[model samples]
Target: MTVHSALPDAGWAFTDDAGPAVTRLLDTLPVRPRLLGLGEPIHGEELFLRVRNRLLRHLVEHEGYRSIALESDCLAGLVVDEYVAGGPGSLDDVMARGISHGWGAFAGNRELVAWMREYNQGRPDGDRLRFYGFDAPTEMMYAQSPRHSLTEVRDHLTAWGDAGQLPDDAALIDDLAGADDRWTDEAAAMDPSRSVGSSPEAVRLRLLADDLRALLMAQAPRLLATAPEADRWRARLHARAASGLLRYHAVMAAASPSRYARLMVTRDTMMAENLLGIAAREADRGPTLVFAHNAHLQREEGHWRSDYLDQALIWWTAGAIAAAELGDRYAFVATAVGAIHHRGLGAPAADTLEGVLSTLPDDPYLLAGRRLATALRTADLAPVRRSDNTDDHGFFPRDPAHIADSDGILFLRDVPTDKP
Candidate 1:
């Protein structure tokens, strides 16, 4: 077995340009934050995930961070959270059922959950770690039906049994929800005409969902008094996801040119809201680590371009939205890579950000985003260029504009096809 040691003070100071790799996360930003977003350029590769696991373990041990949130289904994550918090279930069951988007298949994620479970075995409540999913239940292919989220809200609020102004008939939700396949139909994503989003039943269901969510909030005080913290938090999350699903479907049903753009914006909006809720929940514990793609996590206008769309899609990223409200309480670290061998990518030209960073001795290192951006602006090392190496693969290179607003950056010189 390979032994991994995460010394708290291993790397924080970048002595000169491209010094030793940064190992600590807290002091990289201007202020200590409750939420720190760590972004990856692409998904599915275990290299970035292993690095993420290492960084998170370091933060948990040294920086007083108690939670780690992923870009997965929030509802599904509650199950993983329960498993890690010493609730009933085998590791295999939790991995298969609890995690969303097939992320459980990733060895690094399984390792992360196992580590968290093991770490929480005897720790005090305050010191124990928690897992969270901050993304919307929707996906690029299909948006899950609001059936589970809505029913969960109803069941939680029913703890009061006779709560004032709450939806009484669960049958109404079920009847309106109709069939699950109607909502999960992947074809509806591309063809709006087939979507059941704008139908009268859906519209009514949206209103009912809104009412149920409001009722949950109105009766929050009573629920908190009777229920545990986890139950109350999850009830609220279900409400949020239900409402977000309704809104996402509404947009998905639109036949306009900006349909996909609206979908992206709505998905990210749900993500930002989920993260904010997560921050609130973990406020009493300690800081949190939020991990996702660079586009979803950057503290700037999020952009997605395609040859099919007449115009590029643009909206605020989850990090940008959350940071606006969090102020100094939020920080971001974007990961950039020089090469991805599996994607047939190779060395970056000396003129790009990845190219210059690749020249450093460190295999993977952290740079203060602002200072790095400043240094690059003076053209001391090389003239910067927007990365073109990622045109083929989903992998993206760091842009000069992105670094200024970010707190720090984790850059890898090369990406091996196999797990590191």
Candidate 2:
């Protein structure tokens, strides 16, 4: 396995000239090339199509990758539902169906929508491309209270002694009276400040409810890992820390196996290690594409300096260590999306566009939709902003510096036509 560090000069330098460095590194690979494209703006639909068609051709025809998973939530179920309902359908059809059938919202760009529409349009229902949902809650809560395992919660809801009838408050009270010891322990651990109620039952239920939701969201890696081989499902656990429910604990336990009994250690790490173990067991299965955000995939030992250092140091570092221990059957791809102009979470100003365009090479295609270039040309970039908020909250300046260090890029399929 080769480790390609994009920029060797500076540890934390962000620049716009990352393409050349990435190209140079990729040219040295011997296997069927795994190329990650980080796109710059292009004017027309033709350019967008050219890029996407090339990408699809490479992934589907050349590479023999049967499954393509996105960083989306519950998308797999939708794909299955669509397949079951009819077969292949358009992007608009899928969205309409999702909304009408209470599927959920499509949160991102039109590129994905367009891609789905085009890819699945003409294919037969059974022969249509396969898609999988990445995340779903495996656990649930009743109001806000002590947590219960998904099975336990489901059972409790089912056995209210009223056949096919939903339980009322009194039934719920009786159910809680017979709750497990773990639920009680978890309830006692809640911080009083955040929870509103002072009563023991109320506090217990609230904390349990919160913890149950947490547990449900945390079940991604485990469920993915243990899914039956016949299910034609492939799972990718991509996180830097043991932050996720199953994989994190599994890796941690695996790292120190002797500290705990073999059975205990296995139990701890089983969910997280499920995918890796399954991959090892079924080496003949078709390739599964697991694209992690930058922090999870970057090599910890080399490329000590990173553009995402401020953004994801702690998690990235830990994930790298865990990945190393897991061995090297997996291909780790680090993605670099192009530079973004931060519009400070308000109305777009004219100057911001000019600053972004100024850094681009002189091309009519690149400047086709630019309305802010004239205003930004004269603006000063002196006031660099800082925020203590670690969360992906608030707006900030669109510094091209960050994109400059990216090893590769992933472009939006559709380039916006209308600009304010």
Candidate 3:
């Protein structure tokens, strides 16, 4: 039942018998592979139910993973709020009639709600399952405007600190609160043209904001720095900075609606990464689930960008790094659900590389075939040289050697016809 083993270096391959070892790990009593996937669709309760059932069966019956960590915004606070409001009600009641019942909320997913209720029903009183929201509001706030005024940034930080959500570090709070004034004084001391832009006042304000952020990064625990119990604080600060900058940039880019749209997309990406980091920290205590976008979990190392530079990849890597640093156990599971059929032109359809390659020129196919031949012949296929278009929607192929060290992964796609 033990899944632990020495991880092979980057390119090692497993033998044909690798399947049994993976199956054995899945058969183990307590090794639960976390579920990381996209959000619920607009109107697909049936689809949601099916997915939830599969996840539940695997966790409760097969792996015995009791906790369900949802990727919700304000998840912990939301649950705590609901619990506080409805003292004796179950989570289902809370979802159906209490806090999560208003219009435009997730009230429609009755089956999923019921499952969550039952999951929490048997737990000891005051020991309910933990729900951690990975969304970072600071990034979202910044995305609202392109050019944040010094006053605006300071106000946002102060408000967050006042709220119990942010840490009550007196020294850190004081430094951030005074950051605006310091930026202004420094800007005032500099030459007008260099310190400010063509519009001296406007440019000065922007420079002041930048200077404040730089000062904070220099003095505070920046994202890369190692500090005790600093992850939460660093996450908050980064989220705030990202959200503020996003909002400021959006306002400036308002002239080009298309460009502004792109910025918003980038902001979402940044927010997702921040949320993943937060979720990872919350789950550090034990085996936990991470519900998020497919893009956030899939390994993108072979793609054009360096793994270290990509935000989502960075988030996953950071979790692994943090787990190791804390001496806490952890494992990653990548989930991908493909489309049944192509819908329309200009719309993304789930098509495999093999399927697409069939329509391409013979020369390219031959080249690809030769590359596959090389890979199969060589036991060790360097990860860097792996092709991105091998599987469904280029889903990152799981290297058993990489994952065998911790726990077996569960590929939720292509679900079996009969239920367990």
For all predicted structures, in order, the TM-scores are 0.91, 0.40, 0.42
- Model 2: per-residue lDDT, tens digit, 1-420? 111121121122122332333233334333322223222221122333333334443455444544433323332345443543345766555654432213323333234345544566666543334443332211111011222232243233233222243223323633543444422232222222332234455444434444433433455344345444323122222120112322212222232313223222222232224334333433443443433234323334211212332322122222243345554333333322222223112222323322233233322111111112222334454332322333333222223233322333332212333331
lDDT of model 3 at position 389: 33
lDDT of 3 at 225: 46
* lDDT for each residue of candidate 1 in 1-420, tens digit (9 for 90 to 100): 101122112224332332233344455566788898989988888987888888787777667889999999888899999889888989999988877889888899999999999999987777778999898997668999998888888888777534556755555888889999999999998899889899897898898889888887778777768888778888889989999999999998999988888898899999999999989988988889999998888888876666555578888888989999999899888888888766766787766677767656556767677666655664433433333544554555567666678788777778788774
Give me the overall lDDT of model 1. Answer: 0.80
- The candidates, ranked best first by TM-score, are 1, 3, 2
The residue-by-residue lDDT of candidate 3 on 83-185, one tens digit each, is 5333465655555443221311443234444555556666663444444444433222232221333343344444433223223332243333333332233
Q: Give, for candidate 3, the lowest lDDT window spanning 10 residues.
A: 1-10
What lDDT would each prediction earn against the true structure? 0.80, 0.32, 0.35
| Position 56, candidate 3: lDDT | 45
| Prediction 2 global C-alpha lDDT | 0.32
Candidates 1 and 2 compared: the better one by TM-score is 1
Question: Between candidates 2 and 3, which one is better according to TM-score?
Answer: 3
